[model samples]
Target: MMKQISLMITSVALTFAMNICAQQSPWDKADAIVQSLDPVTFPDKTYVITDFGAVGDGKTLCKEAFEKAITICSDNGGGKITVPAGTYYMNGPLVFKSNVNVHLEKGAILDFSTNESDYLPAVITRWEGTELFNYSPLIYAYHVQNIALTGEGTVNGNGSKKFSPWNNIQTVEQEMLRKMGRTNVPVYRRIFGEGYKLRPGFIEPFGCANVRIEGVTIMDSPFWVIHPIFCNNVIVRNVTVDSHNYNNDGCDPESCRNVLIEGCTFSTGDDAIAIKSGRDNDAWRIGQPTENVVIRNCSFRSKINGVCIGSEIAGGVRNIFIENITIPKSSNAIYFKSNLDRGAYIQDVYVRNVQADTVRTALIRFEPNYKGERSAFHPTLFDSFLIENVTCKQSNECGIYMAGFAERPLQNIVLKNVTIGKVPTPYCFQNGENIRFQSVKVNGKKLDEKPTPKELVKLRVL
Candidate 1:
């Protein structure tokens, strides 16, 4: 009887240990970490920003007040810097430091002045993947750690003003006239060359660690929104990112590591979530790939591709797992685009248990448009792509497409357990090696083909 009891206990212990060793997704850890931190103990409360002569400005540019507040918060062991209940306007970028919290009170608005001079040039930044010294982002953080932006308040870029004020036009086209250099603008534009050149955009946080942006609203970004470059251990949860204007993407996590983006809402004019490893020369300089990304329970609504990778995958991306996503509206539910300029391999990407409604194009696409997207700046490559257990309802077009360039094939991909509703056929595979499927069904029926890949490429592209 004693031996029997011991054996039972030993069996349970072994099972528990194995469960612990298994790879757990980011959502499992996100909620607990958020609850552990006490909001009252934020850095802004302890340091106090008044010493910097910063005041809550309603109309005028309160650059001094914000700088003082940020400086004080930085000096005093880093605390939450308060943007009091009012409109605080700034002409230039405000840099954030380590161990600090930038919390906006209810009804508070941090308005970034759109004057070109206000955003000083020569800031270390990346645009579309290329590295360059460009205009400052509304809220900038570089080389920081343990940072967070939490509140019910808003951060407005005032980008609309730039189009009307600088260029005297209505939208991105007029703003193009106001753009500093006509020649320079194309340097940052998408699908230009091998995707190596710098195209200026908004908000780049480089080499950061343990970052979080929660319960905040970011609107009217001047360019690609919320770009975290070469960061690690990042979390952006419970946030609302909305922009109806041009080129305002919700977030682009490029060359980052250990990232978790969950419980966030994204609605933008462009790709809601654009993943890239690096662009052009930076891809080679920063050879490290984006690793360990887990995006769960995040919903997106975008005019462009909902959740996309490449068009700027110069460095290579891997180990990306996007699950439990609900994209109600988009041109395409999930898109994987690559060309000759992007030489990096995209591998270990798992998109499962996702549902898309009212999709215009194929739900999941891997296309290397040979003559369509050739760039001199950013080099490109496509490899080891996978889509599984995805159900697209009321798709107006085809369901899945894996068509590649004649030179470089889209190889080692698998589509399993996919069900498409209200479509003729589920897939249209053009070129690739080791593409397989298992238990694949469309419109409640099994398919004639099987999807079997060579091996799972364990990599990271956040």
Candidate 2:
């Protein structure tokens, strides 16, 4: 009888905690969205690439074999194209068809050539939110539904010498694209390829639906490692990404909906996962918000932010949930960044059950003043952000740092059940309203007016 009573008490406590979490936002709708997302399904057929005269010795270019396999599979009502073990050197991008799955067996490596000329005859894609005909991503799928890339094999970008060197020459191209983005230049006219210094992403699915990328080891990406733009019902599960180039973000879901990124490990030079919409005028024109995104059970070791909301959030971001995440070595665990040029609303974001170990800079950071070119659409709204049940082993800076514009201050930001071991600086807040902290601890004590870490260091020296 006592054991039954104890179980009942435990259930009641869990119910109470869930209810408290639900009270702050529309969790039921979010849960519904999550539950409805089904895994991508393929027809019952498989095409082996080696049968199509593909060699896997890592030197012979098998672009024709891959293309033929995809064609055969698509022609036969769409099925999986199997890539068996051994390194298959692809000289160009491989496009996916509807209801197709590219399955790689263990020990199979799909390595793309380093020559920029190989990825010519540019395909329609988005570069930093602007639609254009640019160099194709290493693996690209456009307007395809019910497609997946599933396997234990590696999709190697081979970007160390060839693509990584383009970063130095990208300044001119970057400024040109930004200018085109601001001026609402026609996307067709903004062609960049071949001679252009813009590097292509590793895996990107544009304007697609019902996509899944599972269990693939992505490494040495030229740009954003795995990017899905304007996609719906996307699932990226159990993928491993390790890239340390200029903009080697692990995964970026841009202008997408119903995205689930779970059980992924990331060690990258940029954000582990960045949610973006379009950029500036282009994003405003596309007008699609990146909503219904859930990032859970993930580990991140990044040089920059762990999970970022936006700096290219011109189409707004909403209804996001992040839970059960571990940031072992990142500058910030939860980072929301937007600037004056990004005229979008970032609201209804919740982060919970997060563990931060040696977060090099800050645990929770919100910078509404993320640097960008000024625009008339300035005052973006950031509201209803909640962080709960977070524990940090150490932080070099404050536990929480929020800065908002005076005209459009951040609203209803809540922090609950958070503990930080060594946040030597006070929680900083500016231009905010209704910011609440419940059971928040720093250095095993509740936060109060404390000397900065620098001040403490000076006193110790004295």
Candidate 3:
């Protein structure tokens, strides 16, 4: 009888262990997504741009030579187009094709012209969430698969000279574009390029798959640097961006999926990494969500947020994993902002192992009522955020600041193993539920409960 009892106990234990092994962690999907990504590769064949009448003297226009090399490379079953060490001037954009890799050698610089007319003959693109025919991005790929921009070199967008000044003059055109989007105008009719002051992105990949941008240094972008829209299986690794022009966001992945952004460094004028979907009606019509993104081992020093999720997230965002982030200085370490007009959901976000040296604003902030022109009455569902293993050395404002809508409060937020060293205000929770804190310390004091309204600090309207 004793032997039989021991056998039954062992069987039960084995079953329990199996069950535990079968249960998947929330992060298991991230691993699967990474594994499923197809690496962007090219054939061993090489097409040297210098062989195609390209001069690196920085005065001659190399557009024709580049076009010839890229065309020949793609026509002959695709290969690498090598740009040797020197400054090559491009008056127009370099549009990419499938299975082609543009590799720049060390000391090579592809200098883009600041002349607005060079980027005319508008391309189909989404600018700031609205679909329009706009100026071509400096480096653009559309509906291509298995394309790459690789090698140790620089792509300079001379925005400070001319393009940066357009920001102040673009307000009227920007408002008109938003109105067009709101009124459900046909995308074909929403064209604005020559007379409009809307700036173009530095590098944009639209509707692409298996895209890889690695080891390049980007600087002085007119608009967002490295904007990927409607892409899948994208990987941006080891790239350095140091552009401090107006609205020069380091990278904005919009309406993309299965993305991996790792080992990148950013010092930008705006958010270091801002994940977004489309704007409003345009996003709803497109019907694609930004999901399954993993951002790890990144360093940031930005004028705005370090890692952010939309003021333009109207489609939806989900299953984002951010870890091993180092922010030397930023307006906010982790920020989520969406106005009522956004009318979407952002859920299943996980962030861990973040270390911030200095933050001008809150360590983590959620502004459900982000400042924007609200045309509709649709509130976003912000839910299921798990932030842990965060350490902030100094924050000029609060440790945590959240202001959710009363109808749909921010739900299921868990902050664990977090410590903020020198925060003046601990927390400001306006409308939230199921917010649990474990092993969280603010200003050297363990937070046992939520602070009352009287203890809350007033925040300025950003």
Best by TM-score: 3
**Which candidate tops lDDT?**
3
Model 3: colliding residue pairs: none
Clashes of each: 37, 0, 0
Instruction: Give the per-residue Cα lDDT of candidate 2 at 370.
Output: 74
TM-scores for all candidates: the values are 0.79, 0.91, 0.94
Candidate 1 off by > 4 Å: 1-57, 163-200, 374-381, 405-407, 443-445, 451-462
lDDT of each: 0.69, 0.86, 0.90
Model 3, span 1-462: residue lDDT tens? 999999999999999999987896777877888888888888899988899998999989988888888888888899999999999999999889888999999999999999989998999888899889999999999998888999999999998999989999999999899888878899999999999999999999999998999999999999999999999999999999999998888989999999999999999999999999989888988878899999999999999999999978999999999999999999899999898788899999999999999899899988888774556678899999999999999999889997877788888989999999998888888778888778889888898755333234665433
lDDT of 2 by residue, 1-462 (tens): 999999999999999999998795555666778899987888889889899988899999899898888878888899998899999999999888888899999999999999888888888888777777889889999898888999999999988879988889899998898888889889888899977989998899999999999999999999989999999999999999999988888999999999999999999988898899978888989899999998889999999888888788889999999999999898888888888888788999988999989877678887776754465647679989888999999988677877777788888988888899887774677777788887889888885433222211111000
- Residue-wise lDDT of candidate 1 within 1-462, one digit each (tens)? 999999999999999988986767434443444444333235335544444554566576677777777766767787777666777777677777777788877888878776666666546666556655566666788898877888898888877656223322334532332242223444344232121222235566788877888888888777777889888877788888887666667888988877778898999888888887765455665687776677789899988778887666767788787889999888778888766555777777877888888787667777555235454433345666567778878666666766755466677777877777766546676556777766767667687665422222111121
C-alpha RMSD in Å of predicted model 3 compared with the true structure = 3.5
Candidate 2 yields a Cα-based lDDT of 0.86
The local distance difference test score of model 1 is: 0.69
Worst 10 residues of 3 by lDDT: 449-458
